[model samples]
Target: MSDYLIVGGGVIGMMMARELSTAGADVTLVDRRGCAEESSWAGGGIVSPLYPWRYKDPITALATWSQSSYVLLAQELLEETGYDPELRQKGMFMVSVEDADDARRWAAKHHRPLTTVDADFLYQKEPHLKENLGEALWMPEVASIRNPRLGRSLRQSLVGRDNVTVLEHQPLESLIIEGEQVKGIKTHKGEIRADKTIIAAGSWSGELVKPLGLNVPVEPVRGQMMIFKAPQGLVNRVVLMDGRYVIPRNDGRVLIGSTMEHTGFVKETTEDARASLYETAINIVPALADHPIEHHWAGLRPGSPEGVPFIGAVPGYENLYMNAGHFRNGLVLAPASTRLLADQLLGRTPIIDPAAYALSGRVTSG
Candidate 1:
């Protein structure tokens, strides 16, 4: 019997498993398809949300904490696994002025440095950007990581750990409940008993927890992204216009993403979305129009009602916890969310107030 059985092998689940195993708990992680191949792998990996000031406190708290810890975490992972997640602190450039005032206010309140740059400075920073694009906001402290690399490194780091068991391609069928407690989980293979169970199943978390009568409200929000092969310095930093973004990797690949669709569980990439993203990319950086498209794919983000993830005990159930509904920010928020969930499970005080993320807390818009 395992001390903890985590359902889902996305970044959130893997991070939770790592934390639990590091703290001397025997943890078993099961994934339906494969670990980290879902939203965690498909995300753009910007360390902060597209518009940080737009989200409420509950969402910002976790994001900020995780953002603060990513540098050290990346260093540790690099040392342990020799896989650089390519943690880049090149900063984020915002071109949209729709919510500039609101963003400025929030930044001031939160002590985040938000600078307004003129056209000359913007062109100096990112020469490839479209000319005549007026003033923009520069968030200097923002950073990004290669999310797929990070996920792979986390999995690699767990290979020889005696306390961790990672099971891929094991789809969970149902939960084994006894009165008010969750006994274990029923996978396609067979029954596996556990002292506690955590559902970090990403977009599929709602279906897995529905049998237990816990309405987690986690639904699949499909986001499609396109990759373009370019020179290493084709795009100098992360660029944003409205909700879409362009991320340049250490390698010569530039990632342009994404569209949030309400389609239910369908991960297919649409040509329309591809074209739309291509147009958006070229609109920001005209040079991208000359680049060849390398790849196009989609992933389903675990979206909650208010875009905030649940990271606490399941109401009315003992030994059951959840860490899902992160929507588009899972990659950025995973570190802090996992720490908070692990602390709660181990009877330790959480780094942030757990009330806002509790299962019973009132849902608020991000």
Candidate 2:
């Protein structure tokens, strides 16, 4: 039997597998697709919370802790896999449409740096910005990573380890519960028994734990993003205006996103969505209108009601654990999530109180 059977091979799943293997556990990761191809690949890969002050203290705290932890995780992944999950501190520029003061107040309450800048200054910094904007707030510590590369690197780094295995295109069917613990999972091919099992299946975590009567409420929130090969000096920091945002990359590819639509398992890219995103991109950074559309894609984020992730064991099941439900934050959260789950599995002091994030209970308010 494998020491641990991880149901998903996304960022959290792969990271947990890496951690388990490093701790001397034989781990096997099974996924319907390759690692990171799920929401992990499709995300904008920003490391900061959307609006930290909008959520509870624990949510912000966990997000903050996770953000700091990823700095080192990126370096380690680069060394181990030779694929860099390009994490850079470009900071974020949040422009106010009409609520500049409200955004600033929220930023202050959350303890995030809020640099108050005028419209002309904003125009000078990013000349392409729409002149109709009101004010701007800057958060310097906010960072981002190349998300697809992170998933690729995780797969590369873990595939060579003797203690771990990654099986792709093998969609999980059901769980095998034998009394007190999970025996294994029944995949399309055959049964693979595991000493212990953890369901880290992004949005699908809910369905996997259902046989054991464990409930992990989750759904997919799809976001469409468009990438453009920027002409010259254009937008730099991540810009959040109205309901839209812009993310820049190391390569000339500046990503303009996104539209939050709740379409169950519909991963198809749409032209209407692309047109909307392209229009929004030009609105945010007018120069983007000049650049040809390099690429456009859509990604599904495993959103929870509370906007916080579920990262602990099932309430009744002793051996079956869960480490999923990290919606838009998965890319920023890979390292911290892995470390905490490792500590929990290895029987060590946890980085935070695991009860808060336990897979059981009504944490929808979390």
Candidate 3:
């Protein structure tokens, strides 16, 4: 009896349910674990990739559009749900001796506001920074949010509405496909009959669709991050040292991240990863060496081979849709992806061409 059933209760699933329900669709969201218990919970809440110019145009455009909507989206949700999804716009600074040219080229390509500063200038901007530094690139729009809070607010906003329902700890066994059309979903309880279904199951999306003889080219990319509860003024803005970046929260805790490993579903935090994060954080701000490390965690990103998300309809199963494989940029693009998927599912025009994000297209290109 549900018009739409989202098969994951993370940011994507909950946001999509909110969008669809606002468009007057009956919606239910299900998650095997607690809501926002995956990448959405573990993410740094960064609104852009470390270097975004390396990706395709559509990906960049979609992310940009989504990033722009983040402020208003958070405001609206906060107003509706009485929850503050702390979206903070602290700037980003990248310091490096090598990869200078690559950083310059990428920053220019992305139209990021970049400023080249010297050792004295860098120290002046961040007094706690290590003086033994080279040139740095400053990007003003690279912002962050409290992702866990955002996910909770979104779920609350959707669930408070009449047309939305959220089912935590409920897992779908398989999709109910009949002659290339999805009529419902098969789960432990029973068959959930719905007019439309969207698979946004994050890393588990690939395994879930196997019984339906459908494959969405999404793989798990493990990212490990470390948190530092340091002095508030130790670092201003986000800092990118080496391939790793540092994000400072308003609560005097600096988030140091991340390690991109191909290890599948190994969620434990390793000593090497922690050390790597600590060394990088100290390199940016020498004073951070004195602070105690607060947290260390890892999450699985639903990555595609091409690094673009599977955002459109299935080849033979059009009624069954997909919105998975966002990988690291899921937090940045969540709003836009929700709108795009809603547009597609509700027969409205999408913000971008569906062909670019089509699951069938990615499979064929691969």
- Give the top-scoring candidate (TM-score): 1
The TM-scores, one per candidate, come to 0.97, 0.92, 0.93
Model 1 C-alpha lDDT per residue in residues 243-281, reported as the tens digit of each score: 788999998689999998999999999989988999999
Write model 3 residue lDDT over 1-366, tens digit each, in one string.
899988998899898998999888899888888889999999898887776656777778778888889889989989999998988877777777365676668667877566677777666777776776776776677778888899889888987999987888868877787887888787787888788888899988877777766666788888989888886777667777777877877787888888898888788888998888788888877788888988899999998865678887766776888888888888888888889989987778888777788776455321
Look at candidate 3 and give me any clashing residue pairs.
Answer: none
Between candidates 1 and 2, the one scoring higher on TM-score is 1
Ranking by lDDT: 1, 3, 2
Of 2 and 3, the candidate ranking higher by lDDT: 3
lDDT of the candidates, in the order given? 0.89, 0.80, 0.81
What C-alpha RMSD separates each model from the true structure?
2.2, 2.6, 2.1
Candidate numbers sorted by TM-score from highest down: 1, 3, 2
TM-score of 3: 0.93
User: Higher-TM-score candidate among 2 and 3?
Assistant: 3
Better-scoring candidate (TM-score), 1 or 3: 1
Error of 3 at 309 (Å): 0.4
